[model samples]
Target: PPGFVSLVGAGPGDAGLLTRRGAERLRTADVVLYDALVDPAVLALAPSAHRFHVGKRAGRPSVSQRAIERLLVRAARAGKRVVRLKCGDPFVFGRGGEEALALAAAGVPFEVVPGVSSAVAAPALAGIPVTHRGTSAAFAVVAGHAEASYGPVLDGLAPGTLSLVVLMGVGERAGIAARLRARGWAAETPAALVLGASGELVHTWRGRLADLPGLALPPDRTHLPGTLVVGAVAALSLRSPHSTEAQPAARADARPT
Candidate 1:
């Protein structure tokens, strides 16, 4: 019997946000591999399945990408229904493409089940829209871990005209801000950092672009999974007019493990 693989997105941190398709795959999975940031609640859905945690966090030892891919291939070759569950959308910075390619090359039958991405979901959950009429007509989603790749894109953006959503940028907040400023983005541009989006530990910090580096850092200086939103729309949060008044703090659940 030919084995199959399913790459499923678990959504940001909220188990409730997982798609029906993703849940279905989990229920039937013979083996499940999930990311570090995926909520435990979601993992519990595949109670009877063999589970592996292959998630990566900055400054922490993690299962290598190659190892994970190999494991997927091996599991599928064993005629098991393997599920690679990732936080947020599988294709959106989840490295699902690489896994899919590996599966294809290994002749393993596979499918991808998309889930809501933190890029848009994080900001929206923080009450800020990535795009709003007369505020931002376009938005750019960039991986902060690869800022060098965005140099040309950043340089071409017309600052206030385009909203910027940065993922995996909490640690590089200062550099990202400096780079944006160097690219002619205003220091006073509205910016918001949404940490642990859609989870019990969700915390929001809203301020100008100049405040990003400081606001993104907690007193402990530990990096948390966060999404940075910068532009005119970042200032238009529906949560509270006082959202910017609180200094960023780390919640027990939001701390990177």
Candidate 2:
């Protein structure tokens, strides 16, 4: 009989956010297959487990998803408890479901342990409330990577009513804003780019939707992670001690004519 597999959420870069349940799974894991974003410190927690790095860096070559699947199945056949760690919540576009499906088809036993996903975690760590009374009533999370069509899901936003949070949206900023504007989202909506959230190098730059695409940014690409929060709640972040606090009012900064 094959040993079990556990798909674990490693949270955003900070190990402080690892779920207690995830840690327990790691302790029992015979081998740990972890993501690119998991902190090395957290990886140390499972010192006795055989560690395999299956990280996917932006713009860099990475292991094929099929190979990752084979690795998990091979380990399970060896009767090793395998933990497939991923950054952020496994259910939120982390593609954990696909892996689970693969494992199920192969007859592997597995468990899922949730962790704080960076979608909400990075925004909160930046003092930006994703939802607030009288500010944003609903929120949408999107991916920044190119699509089969126009690129990132920012096109789904209706424009003014809800807060929008985007992960992996660091690229193609200008085009994203253009599409959102064409879709009717106000160019005046306040937005921010917060990089390296929850760690010592955390940084944030606030801008109106029109200006966000052109804002100066940090040099780190794939290694430095970020979360973008937009809408009225974007304004409220100024009240927090850690917020950069110099954002222009959303309505005042409409897209240039």
Candidate 3:
């Protein structure tokens, strides 16, 4: 008999956010290859499966994507049920498409189980809505890992008409802010940095677009992935102050009057 593979989304750091179908795949997995940031609770779901860590991080030694694809195919050919667990939606900058193509070329049987992407969930959990009536009717999610990924977004999208959600952008935020400023965005435009959403590490920093580069994550939060929110919607917070989630921190110079 042949084996199977499941490309499952682990959501954005919270086990509770895993979809029902995703959970089912894990429960029956024979071998699991997971990302660096997947929540431990989610991995615990595949208690009976053999676990392997193949996550990649900036400035760290990690497995190559091609190696991961090869591993998936090899494991399946060996008659094992393989699960490639990734953080956030498999197709959202997670290199899931590449893996799927590899599986197809190798003639491996596989399925993709989509989960919540941090691009929207992070900002939403931090009280910033990407879209709201009478505010922003449109939004764009951009990958900030490289200059090419975000350069065009800043050049093309007018700051007033759209909300911009940037993932993996914390490292290049200063450059992003400079580009926005040069693009004629108001110095006081609302901006925010949302980190560790849907988990205890969650925290939000809200401030003016000019002050975005100065909003630093604390030492405990430096390793966590972040989402950058810019435009009018970044100013709105639906989460109540009494809510269980961490409160948003406003920059000293950009605090509300």
Candidate 4:
């Protein structure tokens, strides 16, 4: 019999945040295909399943999206209930659709389970809300990776248009900021890098689009995932605990017309 599969969302980075359904699904999965961003404790939930790590990081040589799909097909063909566990909501830049399409083409049965996205959770962990009244309304979740290698994913961003929450953007930090500036974004626009998202280990670096690259960007940690916020809403950290009031101001999402 062709085994079934479930694309489970692992949430931002906190294992405790995993939904009851997500945890249950992991515990019962015959094989678990997880990403680098999944929390270790969540892996413990799948104690019995064979765990496979699919690399999808910034600069490091990670697994190709196509190869991951092939692996899922291979495992399912062997009659294994494979769990395609990914970080954050599978639909939001999780590449869940690509994997799902692969399964469908192979005549595999599958289900999708959603979870909290790092785009939102990371800012909250650092005391920065992506949305607030009298401040900002709309937001964008961008991919900083230019490609499978280290680059930038524009996602059609505009200057002072929307607050951008960039995932996996730490590696291409300089390039990302450069791109934003090239696209009419103000150099003084407030930008932030929130490392480890919701994990116990977290660091928030605040800066502007032009100065972001100089703010302790560690190239060795390319593969390590982090979230980047670019806009006035992201700068709310100054008012909150993420930073002191001395932080520089960035261009607000909605400025005086």
Model 3 C-alpha lDDT per residue in residues 1-257, reported as the tens digit of each score: 79899999999877878999999999999999999999999999999999999998778999999999999999999999999999999999999999999999999999999999998888877778899999999989888878787898789877667998999998999989998899889999999998777766777888999998777778899888989999999999885534443444321122333
Clashing residue pairs found in predicted model 3: none
- Who is ahead in TM-score, 2 or 3? 3
Every candidate's lDDT: 0.84, 0.78, 0.87, 0.77
Candidate 2 minimal-lDDT segment of 10 residues? 247-256
Checking candidate 1 for backbone clashes, the offending pairs are 36-55
Rank candidates, TM-score, best first. Answer: 3, 1, 2, 4
Score candidate 1 by TM-score against the native: 0.89
Show model 3 residue runs off by greater than 4 Å. Answer: 244-257
Per-residue lDDT tens digits for candidate 2, residues 1-257, read: 56999999998867778889888888888999888878887898798899998888867888888899999999998999999999888887788999999999999988888878888878877668788878878888887656433443556556777888878777756767777887887878898888877665677778898898777686664357877777878766523333233321121222333
User: Which candidate do you rate higher for TM-score, 1 or 4?
Assistant: 1
Residue 38, model 1: lDDT of 89
Window of ten residues with lowest summed lDDT in model 1: 247-256
The prediction achieving the highest TM-score against the true structure is 3
Candidate 1 root-mean-square deviation in Å:
4.8
Error of 1 at 171 (Å): 0.6
Which structure among the candidates has the greatest lDDT?
3
The C-alpha RMSD of each candidate to the native structure, in angstroms, is: 4.8, 6.7, 4.7, 6.8
1-257 per-residue lDDT for model 4 (tens digits): 77988998899867877888999998888999998878899899999999989957545788889999999998988999899999988997888999999999998889998898888887876767788887778887877666443233453565787788887767678877777777788998888887765654455778788888777755554344688998887677533323332221211211223
